[model samples]
Target: MQHFPTGQAEHKRHRRLARRNANGIYNWIMTNDVFYRKVLAHLKHDYSKLEQHARELEQANVALEQDNVDLRNALLAKEQQTAELQREIEAQTKASGACTRRWPARRNQVWSDGWNRLTNELAEAEATKYREKSKTRRRKIKALKNRVRTAVATSNSFEQWLLFVEQEKQDVETLLARYKKKLQAQNRIMTEARVLARELRRSAESTIFNSSTTVNSWCSTFERGIAHVIVAGELFSTSPATSDGSSCLRSDSELIYGMSTLEGLETARRGSPFSRSS
Candidate 1:
């Protein structure tokens, strides 16, 4: 590490003694322009970060909306499937007309007492066997209907599927609502960020305007002091070493100290010559 001389830092502090004005902060900022620029950079970084986060929230909101759409589409498909299932249940509950078309009856049988007076005994026996088989098939069909009715009454009822679909839809709605709430919150944050950024910009603008005004005022004051010094046109000199080994300034034999010393250097320059030539 580089080390400063014992008195070098003190001398530098002495050099900067008159740098500050009545407005302490503005003078310090004018002297150190780096601090002002650092403040600007911080504001810019904060605004950029806020904008980036707002964009991310917008993208997330879009994705969530798309997911909600997909959920709605799925719900539509489920509703269509449920409708088809209901139609199938109704069709199964009632016998189809296709079977009637398959078992076409003879028109002449009604004239002969509806197939009761058959000439061939073998034909009659075949009809009887057919009737028995049809009875057994009808009994099986009734048993299947009973099973289907039991299934409808039990946990496998249509209401179960409808309830499940409703539950899924409700869940999707809930998720969508939750996402909407998050999106709204993000929007609010983004809005607040925008407001904050605007406020920061205004604050920076005000600070710059105030600093410039202060700098102009300081310049005017310095000009007046320089004009007065020029009008005096006398050379000022430092005094002899005092008892404390510190030099006292004797401008026209006046002992000045602290804040007033910087403000009144012209009074000393008018009375004494700092350097004399033979």
Candidate 2:
């Protein structure tokens, strides 16, 4: 049982060992690649969703801004209507005052006395000659009374219209105030949504960047590992060419260097973003 393997058999064994190690590393690298790919896909999906949400928020803000503009326009129109109504009210008030002044209570007696004197003068004339004149005078007095009554009716109507207009103005003011409050609330909501979307987008981008960087670092490490394995295999295959121990020493040193490089990559990976949290 103290028999040693032949040189050819020993080389075959080394080849098998190297192949097995390479296979294991390849499988490990594949697993890590799949994992990182899944992570990247997930991050991309999350970022896409956040971007969609941000777009929706932007649309909502646009709608809100349009609504604010419409509200402001309506408010301006209402103000204009109110001012016009005020002017009409003032004009009506002046007309009503003028109508009142035209028929003053203190002048009522004077008007009656004048009418009586004119009637007495008409009666003193010949009856046949003054009949048509009396009829014309009566018609004139009736027309004057109608005019006074029309003025009074107009004044009353103006008062009613003024009251209605005042009520409408108050209602418009109330509505304007409500619109202002609603517009303010909408603006606040829009601002908050924008801020939330911005923060979410920033966070998503940062996370994706960090994840991408980590994946790249891991990929580089795996690539270096595969390269080192290939070089090591080449050295082992060539080692049989020389009958000196230096070949084995060189292989050992290359392995040590590869291990040290792997250790450094592992250290770097541990210092990555995700690892920092852990």
Candidate 3:
């Protein structure tokens, strides 16, 4: 019975020790739980800060992207403008080259025309000088012929005088015939020369007139082209024949008839003078 009592006391002491150990474990667990909760709260705060920083970084990236896009667009616009300017410059250069080619051709034509005109003028002046000199020579020859005639008329005895007069008459007749023949030849030559000169002058005048008309036509055509380009339409409606009817060319028959009548009048006057002299 005393041994059983000691065993019971040992069991009671074991129960008290287990109860104290359980209480200590409960206190340590509660303290650990508080520390864990504090660690969780700190982790949550750090996560929120990281999220805010990420959002700010995203906004900054978006802004940078927008700026980059704007810069790219500006660069593209500048490139397009430069390309357009280059095209315009190329077109202008081509037009200028064409004008340069035409200028030399026009200048050469003008120079050639000027040279021809100057040559013609020089020839005409030389011909006029020759004509004036020929007229002076003819007047001098006429004076010499007149002096010879007067000397023949003045020479003095009856048979000697008669022989002298007959010889003088023969000499005068021969001289007069020679003078008349020479004068007729000279007149024929002068008339032929005058006709040739008139023909040459008329030819030169016709050439000049035609050249001037061609230049005027070219100018008018050029002006019309410019006007058409600027105003796009609205040129003259009338035909050229109708517009210039007053300046129309006459028939060749009409011209011939007029010339023939003039010739008949001239012939009549010339024959009247010859008849009166006879």
lDDT of each: 0.54, 0.63, 0.56
Query: Which lDDT tens digits does candidate 1 get at residues 32-56?
Result: 4654365557667877887898899
Candidate that would win on lDDT? 2
Candidate 1 — worst ten consecutive residues by lDDT sum? 269-278
Off by over 4 Å in 2: 1-124, 128-133, 209-278
lDDT of 3 by residue, 27-69 (tens): 5555546555655576677778878988988998898889889
Tens-digit lDDT track of model 2 for 58-85: 9999999999999999999999999999
The numbered model that scores best in TM-score is 2
Q: Regarding TM-score, does 1 or 3 come out ahead?
A: 1
Instruction: Rate residue 17 of model 3 by lDDT.
Output: 59
For model 2, the local distance difference test gives 0.63
Candidate ordering by lDDT (highest first): 2, 3, 1
Clashes of each: 0, 0, 0
Q: Which stretches of candidate 1 lie over 4 Å from their true place?
A: 1-143, 146-158, 211-278
